[model samples]
Target: MEPMRGGWAEEAALAHLLAQGYRLLGRNRRTPFGEVDLLLEKDGVYVVVEVKQRRTGRFGTPLEAITPRKVARLLACARHLLGRDDLPVRLEAVLVHGTPEAFRLEHLPLEV
Candidate 1:
């Protein structure tokens, strides 16, 4: 995706999360493992949100874009940032479908 469009998707995802009472802790945080799209906190639980956007399903759905390797890297990055493996960390996904002006966003909790 284009950087500008990706930025728009991230912003939309952030807005959606904020509306649901999730506090933003960080965005585009880089670690040795990988970059985390969004880090948020809600009810004492830390969340690592991976934002994905797709114009169409010709290739695959937005959620399908998250590979297992990507999840591993994100988890490792989150652990490194939090400085502990025992902390309660939740993996989530923000799936954006269609263009920035007309899109459907879905937030789903992921377990892996």
Candidate 2:
């Protein structure tokens, strides 16, 4: 997919997370295994988030784009970056759709 106009849906998702008290620790964090769109923490629990955007819903909901391969990659990325901070972790996805002027946002927390 093409890059979003201002960063990606990740930016909007990140902003939303921050507003909801999630601390921002990383953005676009990448490793040889995979890339994490947003890394956050809430009450010491780590969160790995995927932000997906679509201009149309012809294919499916934005969340439907996450394949098992993508989930595996996200899990690997989180594990690779876990280091010594063995905090509880949660995987999540953020969906953004519609025109920039009139968009919708939804959050989906996933089980890793």
Candidate 3:
């Protein structure tokens, strides 16, 4: 993806999450295993969200960027976040792209 397009997607996601009453806990949170794009909190539950951005349809849908290997990496990152105790939480994917004023948001709830 183009760097500029990717930036827009990230900004759009931040705005979307904020509008949805999700508190931003952290951004680009990295662990020994991998990195989480956004760590959010809502109603006392944690949400580990992976963000994928695509400007065009050349490769496929933006969500398709997430593969089995990516899922494993995300899971490992989640485990790192839960090092001490079990956290009431879920994994999610946010696909964002398009014009700044007309961005699209896709939320995919991941089943653990």
Candidate 4:
């Protein structure tokens, strides 16, 4: 997909999270090494969510896009976010795709 399409997918992911009762803390939060797509707080836990969206299966599914390296970046961002004595947190991924009215959400919770 193009850059603009990717941006819209992210926006749609954020909206989906909000609709699911996540309290948005930040978006595209940057660190010295990487950036986090969404920082959310829910049920008293800080959630570092990586949003993935795919239009077709020719390449791979969105979930397959997250690599160990990407998880490392997410961990780094979570550490930065936690430096302020915030809530206990975990790393997660939100896979979003499908029609606008029927998107998919896969919350793969990581132990932290």
Candidate 5:
């Protein structure tokens, strides 16, 4: 997706997460491994969110975009940001489908 569209999707995802009571810690955070889309904290646990947006389902669902490699990179980046691997970290995905004005989003916990 285009950067502008990606930004819009991220903004939408952030809003959704915020409304769900997840406090924002960071956005587009970069580490040695890669960039983490959103870092959130809720109930004392760190949430590493991967925001995936799809305008259409021609290719696949937004959640289908997440690959094993992507998960690994996200994990590495999250651990790097926290400076430890033992902390409670949860991987999640904010799957958005449709335009910014009319989108459906689902928050799902991702398995490590």
Candidate 6:
């Protein structure tokens, strides 16, 4: 497998989200547990996002890559970033797939 450029996918996801009216809060927010790919706010609600991308479906869709263990880690990281575990914040996954010239982005909200 070729090395994937995560930054490229992340940038695509960020631009897609922004165009959809989400306000950016942070990107690549790190914690001991994991990193939140994108943290956003809209309509006074916070969203913690995970971005997954693939150059092709020869393996699987980007959404298929998100395992339960990853979700747990993402939840923990989001909690750490917010300094609480009970926030009503929502979790979302952004899937970016395809080639650079014809990339496709999909948002799966309420992931957690």
**Which candidate has the top score in TM-score?**
1
User: Which pairs clash in the backbone of model 3?
Assistant: none
lDDT score for candidate 1 against the true structure:
0.94
TM-score (C-alpha) between model 4 and the true structure: 0.79
- The window of 10 residues in a row where model 2 has the poorest summed lDDT is 3-12
Cα miss at 104, model 4 (Å)? Answer: 3.7
Question: What number of clashing residue pairs does each candidate have, in the order they appear?
Answer: 0, 0, 0, 0, 0, 0
Tens-place lDDT digits, model 3, residues 31-95: 99898888889888888888898766777988788887888888788778767447777788889
User: What is the TM-score of candidate 1?
Assistant: 0.94
Query: Model 3 off-target regions past 4 Å?
Result: 1-5, 99-102
Residue-level error in angstroms, candidate 2, position 106: 0.6
Off by over 4 Å in 6: 1-4
- Writing each residue's lDDT as its tens digit, candidate 6 over 12-81 gives 8888889989999998888999888899997777888999888889999898899888888888888899
Taken over the whole model, the C-alpha lDDT of each candidate is 0.94, 0.84, 0.80, 0.79, 0.93, 0.85
Ranked candidates, highest TM-score first: 1, 5, 6, 2, 3, 4
> Where does candidate 6 have its weakest 10-residue lDDT segment?
103-112
Instruction: Tell me the deviation in Å of residue 10 in model 3.
Output: 1.4
Clashing pairs in 1: none
lDDT of 4 by residue, 31-106 (tens): 9868898899888888899988876667898878998888877887888867864558778887876645566656
TM-score, structure 5 vs. true: 0.93
Candidate 3 scores a C-alpha RMSD against the true structure in Å of 2.8
Better of 1 and 5 by lDDT: 1
Top lDDT: which candidate number?
1
